[model samples]
Structures are given as C-alpha cells and as structure tokens.
Target: MLKNIAELNVIVDKYVHWFNHERISLKTKGLSPIAYREQVLGN
Candidate 1:
C-alpha cells in the first residue's frame, strides 16, 4: 500500500507516463496505447 499522498501521486504519475509513452503491448503491434490510437486515428 502507499505510504502517503505524495507516494500515491508518484505511483499514479509513473503509471500515467507509462501508459502514455512507455508501456507497449502485442495487441497494438508493439506500440504504446496512445501511440497506436494516434496512428489509427491519424492524429
């Protein structure tokens, strides 16, 4: 469990960054979710 709000925020920030820029999956053809969406949407 998180120790405090600051710690929780750190975890949240890490996940958010990962989700947007780092995390990848085979389903998206090895791209991060946002990147794959942008590619598909032509953003």
Candidate 2:
C-alpha cells in the first residue's frame, strides 16, 4: 500500500506539471493552466 501511494504521488506530480505547464485552456483564452491561474489570482 505504501509503495502504491508513493507511485501515485509521483504520477500526480507529473500530471500537475503537465497540466500547469503544457496544457492550454479555452476558458483562459488559450493560456496554459499556470498562466491562467496567475492571471486570476493576480500573481
């Protein structure tokens, strides 16, 4: 169970990076998720 949890954590981290850095969003006017989040949060 612990090993599975660790592997899941790694997968989730990779997905987070891909979503935030690589994937674009139509709702954000084609901005990457990270950029759109920053814009909305004023960061």
Candidate 3:
C-alpha cells in the first residue's frame, strides 16, 4: 500500500515512464511508443 502522497506520486511517475519509454507493443511493431515516434520523426 502507498504510505503517502509523495510515494504515490513516485510510483505514478515510474509507471508513466515505463508506459511511454519501456513497454513494447505489437501494434507498434515491437517498439515502445516513444521509440516508434522517434523513428517516424527521424530523430
């Protein structure tokens, strides 16, 4: 269980980071959303 608001915020931050930067999706052809975006944009 979350002990405090600060800890909860930290947990949320980690989850958001993972969702955007780490988690791969088959719909994205096995790339994370951010990676796919970068590839599309030529970054």
Q: By TM-score, who's the top model here?
A: 3
> How would you encode candidate 1's per-residue C-alpha lDDT over 1-43 as one tens digit per residue?
7789999999999989988888999999999989999999999
Q: For candidate 1, list the clashing residue pairs, or say none.
A: none
**Model 2 segments more than 4 A misplaced:** 1-3, 38-43
Model 2 clashing residue pairs (backbone)? none
What TM-score do all the candidates reach, one by one? 0.74, 0.59, 0.94
Q: What shift in Å separates residue 8 of candidate 2 from its native position after superposition?
A: 0.9
Cα RMSD to the true fold for all candidates? 1.7, 3.2, 0.5
lDDT values, one for every candidate: 0.93, 0.90, 0.98
TM-score of 3: 0.94
Shift in Å, residue 26, candidate 1: 0.5
Over the full model, what C-alpha lDDT does candidate 2 score relative to the true structure?
0.90
Query: Could you arrange the candidates by TM-score from highest to lowest?
Result: 3, 1, 2
Give the per-residue Cα lDDT of candidate 3 at 30. 99
> Candidate 3 clashing pairs?
none
